[model samples]
Target: MERVYIGMGSNLAAPAEQLREALKALGQLPHTRLSGVSSFYVSDSLLPGQPRYTNAVAALDTALEPLALLDALQAIENGQGRERLERWGPRTLDLDILLFGDRLIDEPRLKVPHYHMQARAFVLYPLAELAPGITLADGRALDGLLAACPFEGLERL
Candidate 1:
């Protein structure tokens, strides 16, 4: 099984509940095991007019590869009533593939370790909560990234 991390967030329709359900749904995927999860967190909108979002991180052991895992995540988001209204727009559920083992992927459809994850407290804080001393393939520690991240809206739920 490959270790993977996913970032989940919801800013609409009972955000906390959506986040919880999303986690459950994510765990239901075939050949996957939900290994760990971070407590929910609340963060102010990153976009000018978006609502504040409730976020968390989840670690999973999965048999699927990076692309297949991304497909599963997209399906989970659709199951949760997510819509691509706009780039970085509000949604009922937003699932991001933060890391896929120690792999670094660069493709138009996906970017492993998540292109902007380290820069966002909403993603980093909860990720550190779940795996405090973990290091990515690039040798960056989760705790170190959290310490330097500048987004101040992160708060544990």
Candidate 2:
């Protein structure tokens, strides 16, 4: 099974509850098991005028390929009422594939190591909490990335 990291966030409805339910659904994915989850954190929206977000990172051991895993994650988001009404818009749930083991992927629909993870504290802080010292395919350490990420207003819950 490949170790995967998923970043989750929500700002609509009950954000923290949405993340809790998403974690349960992640553990139930076929051929996948939830291994670790970070403490929930609240952060201001990346875009101004939107609601604050509750975010966390999840580690999973899965046999599914990257695309299949992405599909499963999207299904979970849709089930939880995610809508793509606008780019960076508020949502009921947002699930992103932060990393897939040590593999690097750049596809039309997906990108591993999440194109912007290194720059966003909302992703890096909680991710560091769960997988400190983890290195990306490009050899950058997660802890180091967390250090360099611009501080956003993140509070653990």
Candidate 3:
């Protein structure tokens, strides 16, 4: 099984509950096992005029390939009533593949070790909380990357 991380956020309708339900749904996917989950956190949205979001991260052990895992996450989001109307728009749930094993994959639709992972505090903080010891494909530790982050809008829920 490959170790992976998922960054989750929701800004509409009981975000904490949505996040928990999303995690449970993800865990129920075939060949995937939920390993760890971080505490929920509230963070100011990066997009202007968007509602504050509750974010968390989940660690999973999965046999699915990266693309397949991404599909599974999106399915979970859709199951939670997510409707994507705009970039970074408020939604019932947002699930992003933060890390996949120790592989770096860059494609038109996906980027493993997530292209923006290092720069987003909303993603990093909760991810580090769930899997502080994780080592990225580039060999940098999750905690090390988080130590250099300067974002200040996150607070535990």
Candidate 4:
């Protein structure tokens, strides 16, 4: 089974509860086991006038392939009332494939080592909780990323 890390966020409908539910659902996926989860952190939303977001990272050991896992994640998001209304808009739940077994994947539907993770404290800091002193599939060091992305405006809860 490949180790996978998932980035999760929510700003609508009891964000923390939504993540808890998502964690339970993740554990239920076929050929998968929820191995670790990070502390929930609150950060302001990307756009103004939006509610602050609750974010965390999850580690999973799964035999399912990347796309299959992505599909399951999206289903979980949809079940939690996620909407694709606008870029960086508020949502009920959002899950992204952060890494998949040190494999660099570039697909139309997904990208491993997430294109923007290096710059987002919400993603990088929580991820550090689950996997410390790590390196991405693309050769980016986690510590280096943390150094570049300050943990400003992020409150661990």
Residue-by-residue lDDT tens digits, candidate 3, 11-32: 9999999998998898799999
In terms of lDDT, the best-performing candidate is 4
Give candidate 2's TM-score: 0.97
User: Candidate 4's error at 142, in angstroms?
Assistant: 0.3
- List the candidate 3 regions with Cα displacement exceeding 4 Å: none
TM-score of each: 0.94, 0.97, 0.93, 0.98
The TM-score ranking, best first, is 4, 2, 1, 3
C-alpha RMSD by candidate, in order = 1.3, 0.9, 1.4, 0.7
- Tens-digit lDDT string for candidate 2 (73-156): 999999999999988899999999999999989999998879988888989989888888889987889878977886658898
Give Cα-based local distance difference scores for all models: 0.88, 0.92, 0.87, 0.95
Q: Candidate 3's error at 52, in angstroms?
A: 0.3
**lDDT (Cα, tens digit) per residue for candidate 4, span 49-104:** 99999999999999999999999999999999988988788899999999999899
Give stretches of model 1 more than 4 Å off.
none
The weakest ten consecutive residues by lDDT in model 2 span 143-152
